[model samples]
Target: MTKGRRRTTRDADHESFDTAYDAIMARWPDGTESLTVPTPYGPTRVHACGPRGAPPLVLLPGGGATSAGWYALAAELSKTHRVFAVDLVGDAGHSAPDPQRPVRSVGDLTAWLDALLDGLSIGLPSGPPVDLCGHSYGAWIALHYALHAPTRVRRTVLLDPTGCFAGFRASYLLRALPMLLRPSARRVRRFLEWETAGGAPLDPALLRLQERAAVLPAVRPVTGPRPDPAALRGLRCPVLLLLAGDGRAHDPHRVAARASAVLPEVTATVLPGVSHHVLPYAMHADVHGRTAAFLGPLSRPSR
Candidate 1:
């Protein structure tokens, strides 16, 4: 409706939404407790797991990816840290779609997140702001939130974040252009295939579910603005940037060098031979390990 992607009409919204929501919930790792946190935009869905008292870590998925996308990583990381994987509002997920208040700017994006955090008791006297981990588009959101609301964040982990350091490659835009122009289950599958081409094959079942959701008519999702250089250079909290060597999403060397030079406290690591599809064995292990260490008590606020 908005571009190449087919927007699911109101008539078909219920059936399609139920199926996609169920599939996402079914695939979640054991012990994940699903909850809906109310926000001004709508009710946001989150998958919470791990010890209640442990330091909290919020997981945000990439463009068109669901909370299920974080299932594997969350399952592994939850052993030490409480993990909450959210289906970003306005995306094709259980989170209620809101075309009315679309997150077109950094202010809009951060406002919705601030409301969601308040709903989750983050930054309150009893609840402290948690660490953030974002992939692709979600990484963009995490970065903005950290810049705009530094006091609420402990640290951040960005995995293959596109658009922060630079723009998407021409090839990426070309491949994605089709889906935005003429969205179909087939094109969605094709895009997934291309994204997972080298690193690791995404879970087949998850891909199938996403394909269905993509074809269903739904509200177009948010497209965040590119980060400003001044904000990127003035981050208050520490951050960990994980780049894949062969990933087309962003230029690894350039992003790392910029992060080292611009950011106050950052650890940049480039995993050799890893692709943009980071959920695979090697990428997941390295990214998760580094994130866990970064999210450890050592990084917590000074009491």
Candidate 2:
């Protein structure tokens, strides 16, 4: 007879987040390949797509997200630019594990990005610099990277970015509390299924893939200190803030207003009828067109 499987607290927690992640991944599917870049910390795996000759645009996903999160947007953007959709080093999806040292602060995350880009040999030629587009927590990382390495970035876009507001709101905390408290796979899967189907219907195959990737064991656990807004004043790149029309947790318009006031070179736009999670779908075309127009004139020919 087969022995019964053991269930422990750690095991339960692991299964929860794993299941949730798998569900989310099931909804967003792509055939992009991966690359491993050797860094002082370790080898970082980056998932990418797009034609090799096109201008480079790096896409970063939200918290607990993978490069696949950019599926809808990258597909459109890649038509005109080489899109490098990266799995945030320590979070979910296919990024290599961090070194024995802990990634505890905003600076550490920025350094990790620098090492990854340097190792990948991106942004050296033409002196044009790389464009960064990040959603949610990834936006925070993008902004921090721009601040840390101003010369390396040509332009930056923050899509429904989190942590840009003065503080995390109560509703956000309430929603996040469940994930923090249980962090279970089943719960996450339910959330993914809901999110995938909750918005305007998406492709069925993409939804299935998102569900599978969400439950993988390799997804990183959430940790580390919160970011400080004081960090925003340090960023010196041309910034674009895209606010979702139906943003509820933090007022997107308010955030955009504040960001525009504080960020030296900034532009803000609100996409009507788009929810935070569904902004990519609603704004993908507009973003792609606008980005191509913005970056085309800026990229310099290699001398």
Candidate 3:
């Protein structure tokens, strides 16, 4: 009976999470399509939109933010580029994790990304390199992938990325401890409230989805040391590093200084009045303008 009850509770948590996710997705622009691309890790869920022949721009959301969280930004980028917003493997969204092939390390994570890109038919031989953009933890993944396969990526964008250039603020880690140690809806909400303090109000639907994320069965995310500074200096692709001026996660100025100094080709900017968790969403207009400017005009239709 105990086992059965546990199973039932897990099922309910998944249901609630989907309901909230769907609610948020319902607001996405017209013609948006959700498809699953199979990878060795699992079937990755991607929300695709924009013209089919346009250059692909992949968006990776922060941890627990889900692909649906990119709705607003996706809509903007989709106008000029095909947008593929992904639900990361082993996370709380629609993507399923292969228990047998768990992503155990940063190496595994990069391999999973390679398979995912191949499944999507991106990169050399057939298709041109795609632009990669990510936020927070997702930004970490994007940076690592760019380093792993520079030839496969045309450009990269990192939005308030953590653990890439600077260490996390000790106070920020302390506040996240409760949610990390004993995750609950209340704890998740509390964490967001504290971190996003002084930022514009967040979308209610997005908040609901995040709260439900706490109860969903999720795999432990891969964690590792910061990328080597030597590797940063070696990266060749154009990069846009956008920091949240009010972010409590780390010193935005310090991040800017380090990134500008190490990266061979980088454009770093700080968007004031927004915090880490509320970014891209909070500074929608500013983020879109800078991103589109950096990405330049859309690609010509594939021959």
Cα displacement (Å) at residue 8, model 1: 12
lDDT of candidates 1 onward, in order: 0.76, 0.66, 0.88
Ranking by TM-score: 3, 1, 2
TM-score of predicted structure 3 = 0.94
Better of 1 and 3 by TM-score: 3
lDDT, residue 104, candidate 1: 62
Candidate 2 deviant stretches above 4 angstroms? 1-32, 125-127, 189-235, 281-284, 298-303
Taking the tens digit of each residue's C-alpha lDDT, what string does model 2 give over 1-303?
237967776565556545554554444435556677777555666766777767778988877656765666777777777778787666665566656854667767777788887776777654457889988788878877787777788788888888765455576566656655655545555554444343344444434444444445443433344344566666667788887666554777788788876787787887665566556544355565665565555444422
TM-score per candidate, chains pooled: 0.87, 0.77, 0.94
Model 3 poorest ten-residue lDDT run: 294-303
lDDT tens per residue, model 1, 1-303: 356776557436557656766765675567789899988777899889988878778888887777776766777778887888888887767888565665666687789888987887765446676788988888889998898888788888988788788777888788889988888879988876886677655666677667767765555655655777787777778889988877776578888887788788899998766777554224366776877777777634432
Each candidate: RMSD: 5.0, 5.0, 3.0
Backbone collisions counted per model: 7, 27, 0
Candidate 3 lDDT, 212-250, residue by residue in tens: 999877899989999888998999888999999888999
Q: Is candidate 2 or candidate 3 better by lDDT?
A: 3
